[model samples]
Each structure stands twice: as C-alpha cells, then as structure tokens.
Target: MSSCNSAPKRVGNKVKCNLSFFDTIRKRPIGPSGYQIGYDDLVALKLYSNFYHYEIDKLEHDSHYGGIFNLEFSLDGKLLVAACEGKQVLLFDAANQKQINSVDSAHQNCVNCVRFLNDKHFATCSDDTSIKIWDIRKLKSCLRTLHGHSNWVKNIEWSEKDNVMVTSAFDGSIYAWNLKSHSENNMLYDKVFLMNGLMRMKLTEDGSKMVIATTNGYMIIIHDLNLATLATDLRSFKPSLYRLMQISDQCYPVATIYNYLFSPTRKRNRIEFIDDFPNEAEVISSLQIHPHGWSVVSRNINGEENEEWTSVHDIQSRDPSDYENSFMYIEEDIPDEPEPEEPPNQRPTDLWLGYISLDEYSNHNRDPSQVSQNIWENNFQLPAMGILNSGLIGVNASYNAYFQQHPEQRNKVITNLPRMTHFIKEKNVGKGYIKELCFSSDGRIICSPFNRGVRLLAFNNQCQELSMCVPDNPQQLKTIVEMNDYHKDIVVSCKFSPTHYQLVSGCLGSEIKWYQPVV
Candidate 1:
C-alpha cells in the first residue's frame, strides 16, 4: 500500500512477484502423423517404453481424400496395390513404398475389393456391378471389363488352372467367364451354369466341384460336367419296385411273386404295375423301407433237398444272425457210413436262395420219406422262396427329420473336421471390421492397419531383446515407444509386401501409410 514500485519488496514475498519465472513447460517433438514425440536426454531411455530404436525416414499423403477400402500384393510380392472408395486403384513399390502408378475412375462406383491373380495381373470388383482385369505392365488402362452382373458384384475369384473367372452378385446369380475368349463380339460366355437362388459360390481346389451356399440355408454341390453324364445314364434304365408273397403249401408253387403299386408323389397314390407273378399269390405283409429315396436288393432261391441238408429254408432263418448260428447237416439217411460215392451233394432243401428260382420236382424214385432229394435226381424241383424280397423305403424322410431337429449341431461334427488350410483370428487391432487382410509371401510377419493405428504382428514369437538405441540419443536407447498411433477412424484395409519387410495401410480417410520394421 506504499509506493507502487516498493509494494512487492516484502519479506518471503507475501504477494507473488511478476519479475521473472522459470520455463516449466517442455516442448514435444513432432512425429510422422502430427503426434508429439516426448523425450528427455537423461530419462529418454527410461521413458521410451514401447517404441523401437528406429528413426522415421519419410511420410507421404495419399492421392484420394476419401477412405481406402482394400489392398493386395502381387504373387511375386514385389508390387503393392490399394483400392480407394473414391474410385481409384494405386500401385506402389513394395521396397520403398514409392507411388508407381494409379488408375483413376477404375470403377464407376466405389471399388470395394481387389485381388491379385498372379505376378502380372490382378482383378477388381465394384459396386457398379462390374469387374475389371488389370495388367501390371500396362498400368495406364484395364485389360478387360467383365460385364454381366446386374447388381453390385460382391466377389470375384480368378482360376489358376484355366482362363476362367467367377463372380458373385447381389442379384442372386453366379457367372463364370472365360477371360481368354472374351471379346466384344463374343462378350456372352460360351457356357452358363445358372444358380438362380444361390447367394454365394466357391469353387473347390481343383475346380471340379462348386459349393453354392444358398440363402435358404442349404449347400448344393454342383458337378457341372459330370451331372449331365449321370443324367443321361439314368434316363436309359427303368426303375421298378418289386416284392414277394407267401403262397400255400399244397400248390407246389413254381414262383412266388408280390405285386407293388408305385407311387411317385406323396399325396397322390397312382398305382402302377411293378412286377408280375407266375402263379396266383396273396400279399401277406408290406414294408415301406425308404421314405424319400430308392434301393434294390436281390436274392436266388433253389428248391434242392438232400438227406444231408446244407441249407435251411425258413423265412425266419434268413435273419442275418441265423446264418451264423445254424447247424450243418450231411445226408441224414446215410447213417454214419463211409460210402464209396461222395455223399449226394448234401443239397440242403432249406437253402434260402435269392433272385432266381428252380422248377418243381415230380420224380417219385427215392423213398417217400426222403422228401429232401438232390434237385438233379428229381425231374423238377419246386422253386423255393429266394431270399425274401422285402422292400424297405422312406430313408430320406428319416434323414430330413433328424436334420430339422438339431440343424446347427448335426452339421457341426461334419464341418469341423480339419481341412488343409483355414483362417483363424489373431489379435483384434481396430474397432471397425477388417475389410481386407493379406499375408506376405513367406508368411513371417503380418501387418494390419485398423481404423485407429497400423499394427505389426510377428508371426514367429522368437526374438531376443537387443540394446535399445535411439537414433539421436544413446541415453534414450533404454526407453521404449508405445505403439498406439491409430485413432478413431477405421482402417479398412492393409497389405504386406511379398518381397520385402514393408507394410502399407489404407484407412477410412482414403490415406495410405507405409510402415517398415526397424530391423
């Protein structure tokens, strides 16, 4: 309250003095993506916790302002390609992450996907319902534009064996085209296999089979070439349903036949003559074996009877279990005597024959009690019932019942069987969906760029800790740099070079970032 200049000279500075103050705020270094790289010479090694001791070389901005959608590398791993939703496809050098060439307006709409068929060429599909083939040598223009799909083309697969390409569309059809023969005059494909209601189509390893996953929750296996052959063979044969009947004992029936009415449809019973019988027979029983499929079983029946019966002729004895337990009998009349003649072919009268039948026997030469005599000795041998012609139907019905009851679990056992190759989730790197992922040719390291940050994952977790040395500060070598650079936006796609240890990331901002390992 004294003079204005003399007021701040109090002991211990009861009031704060504004004469001077030490600079307490430390400035942070600017990083590649406008991030602050905080460091200290004395505690730099201790502070750089998660970062490697590498130096940032260069940074480049992508051409498009929209978001990146997909990325792929050529088979040789030397060239890297990226697709932007802004209708551009850029090819870059894998070694140095340098922009080699780019295609503008590659698609009328957003380029949703890209895939490399080989070292020289690749394919791209778009929402414009078109697929374009590109040659790496001539980066200026597309080699061919495949047109057929009416709606958005969701996926495209290039065949390695033949010059064939397959595409799936939202219009619920799959089209296969011969790329080699494609021309303006011959634009329409030579062969078309129409999958009217299928949602997706994937070819097997050899292209011999096509697995079509339908929206109705069924997988149809189509053998395109073989199906026609099978159909032709099937049309040449006549399929008949046959049955057997039990006739009386006195008639000495030569043949026992049962008539079956064929019904093709479930609701309508349209009776059709299945088989004919020689004698009047009565159907005692009928069995519906297969519910939805067809089957055929045949047997032979011979009315041969000998004293030493080797066969048993009872219908019940034909049970599979009876065959194992039945006894073997030699001629019963020739009592335990070793005769010079080989005991009359112990032809057992009870032998349950199948399919064919023998004639009746009228010869009254043997003893009346010896009703079981060799068929050759008797002028005519009565045809015994060949293996009982029992028909069972309705097998497919049972299979459908089981499938409907536990649909999810029934196929679990069949689908989970190990295959030659499969994809498994590693680490979740970003908040958004992984639009695209590709492995380096050798498959050592995997680089995934998410919406937030790009991640470098080591496939083989075997490495020793080397001395931590910063580019400028040796003392800061002990510190690590935390790798959490990615932020809010999604990283739509990422790819690794097959020839080098470099990675490129395409983010939602339509920006592509290049990353290389410190080693």
Candidate 2:
C-alpha cells in the first residue's frame, strides 16, 4: 500500500483535506441524549459541515438487494427513488433516507432508467421493452406502462415545459411521448441503419433541437421538433433536412454542442472531438452539458490507466484568426504544461469507481435560457489547476503515443482534478465497483453506490477530524455505516435532489435505497 504521506496536502480554503485517524482527537460531537454520535453519522456530518457541530443519525436500508443502474431525487429533495436490475421500483422518504415503499415488479425485467415528470409523478424504462409511469403517493403499482420498443430501453429524457419525454432503446429507435395528448411519435431518420444504433440523445435547451449520439460514432442533428406539429400529421415530425458529422470510427461520442461534439478515445489523459479548431482533444470523461447548454462538466472517470484524473471544460467560441500563425494555431490565455507522469508504484486511491455529472442535478429549476451567458465566454479554456493526479493508473500506450505526436504546446492545455474533500471506505462491504456519485442540491453532501450499500460523505471547506476521535484499536474502525439493508447485491446507480440534501441509489439485484441526512 502507498503511504498516506504521499497524498497531497490542502493549501488553505482552496483545497479541502482529510487527516488520518490517528491524527485526530477524541472530542467529537455529542447528541441530545449525551450519547456519542454514531461514527458513520459523525463522519457524514463532518463531511457535510463547515464547523463539525452536527451529527448524522444512523445507517438505513430498503427491502431490495439488487444492483441499481440509476437513482434520482425529486426537485424538492424530499423524496429519493431508483430503478433496479431486479425489475423493481423503490422509494424512500428524503428527510430520513429510509425505505417507505416499493413495487416488487415495476417491470418484467431490469429497470434501466428513472425520470421525474413532476413533483408527484415519475417514469421508468426497463429491459422488458416498455416504460411505466408511477405516482409517488401510490408505491404499490404503476399508473401505466407505455409499450412499443422491442428491446431494452436504455435511457429517457423529458421536457416538463413541453410535457413530452423521449425514450431511446437498444434497437436504434427513438420514441417521443406526449403527456398532454398521450401520443407517441416515432423517429425515422434517413440512412438510420448506417449508424450502428442509437446510444444516447441530448435535447437543446428550449427543446427545439436534439443531438443524437449513435453507436457508430456519428452525431445526427435534428431540428424543429414539435409534438403539436407532429401529432396532427405524422409526417410533420420527419425533418426534411438533418445534419450529420463523423466523430469517431466506432467509439461512442458522449457530449455535443451546436457546433462541436465530444467523443472518447482509448488514449491516456485526453478526449478528442470532431470540431474544427486549433485543438480537437482535451482530457475529460463522461462529458455532460449543463442544463443551460452553455457549459459542460466532466463526470471524471477514475481508473489505474489514466491516474484517476478528470476535469471540467468551459466552451467558448473565439475568432479563428486570433489563434492563427504561420506555423500553428493556439488558444489564447492558456499556458502549456507537461503531461502528468504516472508514479512507478502508484495505485488508484479509488478503483473500479464510476461518476455522475453535476450537470445532471444543477440548476434544474432555472429556465434553460437564463443559466449564465458567460458560461461559454471562456471557450474551452482549461481550469486553472491543470491536470491532477487522481492516483489511478492505466494508460493506452498506443493511443497515448499517437496523440503525443501533437506539439506539447497543444496537448498541454488541460484542466486539473477537483479537490477531494474526504475519503470514506467501508471494511465489511465487498470491493464491488461504484457506478455513480452525486452531490445534494446545496453542495453539502455527496453519495455514491457501494458493493451492497451506498456511502455518503457530507462536505464543506472545513476539516473537522482534528477534534473527532478515532477508535482505540485499528480493527474497531470497521465502517462508518453499513447500508447493506438496501440490497443483497451490488449497488450501481444514484442521484441527488435538485433542491435538498436527500439522495437515491440503486443496485444490481434490483433494489433501491433512499437516504436522507438527519441532524
């Protein structure tokens, strides 16, 4: 194991830091009955608090034990729900984060995605080749199951303002559902079979355009999407003209802009795109556009190959001639730096882990048109911190060498990793991979799925372990909390409330865990 001393230290308020157990004191917070607060809860409180004056209640669980692929919190952050592989839909009270109710067979098979249509209603899609709508008040059954797709439903995106939702399936088909009229519109793009299959899709801020990512690494851009126009006459939904661009030969392109699209490469420390520019690659992963559509954040995938590094990139457009010269073109106001060198004996502090984008939960209530005009102002300028060492190692040697051919000055423009406030590790929980991590609306707490449970870390600028006590013996520090009651199998997906401190998570065994922070 690498020595803890090798880890970087925080430099004032800019970087959050964590301390070793032996380095702490014994004056942790005491609860109302004068009892020492639970260790796990105490840790959560500290992680979420600025003064460490608070305490978390205890570990809570739900009835199911399957691996969850996704979870979402309501807009108010009071309710948490999830879709499980076991074909179950689970619910919980966001205030206490405990299981309140669930539907054992929300679908005939695995539920892949869950989305909220509004405060009282939500929708889910599953491997059973259908989508079901449910109400939070009645958890025992679904309100309706919408059928059409002949394959697993991979994802669902809804526009509450338009009262329409889009569902994409494994069969390369896209279906539009109208909440008001209860109608469906099928998308039949020209040359659809040439693009392997539909992998994912993104709607423009006002729902006027959709950037569809296909399995063949091409982006199909469709415009003029109107349910009213389409429902009245089916042909109205068929766009007469569509724009297509080749992004990758076969790799899945994850994010896109009006003029640019982002795709992944097997290379270490970089993501290339299919845009015309001085540079076409940046170091990022799981790139997601902000709800407002002007900015994007990296979901920051960590692994041994890339040193567990990830960063957020701001998209700004600039005059091409400003960066042009006889020999090459370059972005202005950005400095060049050497790529980070992987430590010979370094190991990822967190391994087999997954990530969820802040874009997924941030600014859900705000009008997409008003997010921040300055969001795209910087125009792809790397964050000031530069590339960070996530302590994970794994690199594609061939791809790395090929991309390395670009001048160091071009490859040098990249962002750094976000500061890690604290690390929460559970001993008894098996080392099953974590699929997603989410932060509460206020940015106070973050939660990620665990092997058989979910782990939460309350976060703020302060490091409170200085006064908290560590167990007298090493073995005594088994875990901060054991959330195994939620699922008997591995937990996979999770989401946070857009406005509250509540959380929702799911597992592979098809169970859901709803957790709330109790002070």
**Residue 245 lDDT, candidate 1, scale 0-100:** 18
Residue 252 error, candidate 1, Å: 47
lDDT by residue (tens digit), candidate 1, 6-64: 11111122212221112112222333343223222212222111122122222245445
User: Ten residues in a row with the worst lDDT in model 1?
Assistant: 308-317
Q: Model 1: runs farther than 4 Å from truth?
A: 1-65, 183-434, 443-451, 456-483, 486-488
Q: Candidates' lDDT values, in order?
A: 0.39, 0.43
Model 2 spans with C-alpha error above 4 angstroms: 1-64, 182-195, 204-291, 297-434, 437-491, 502-519
TM-score (C-alpha, index-matched) for candidate 1 = 0.43
lDDT value for model 2: 0.43
Which prediction has the highest TM-score against the true structure?
2
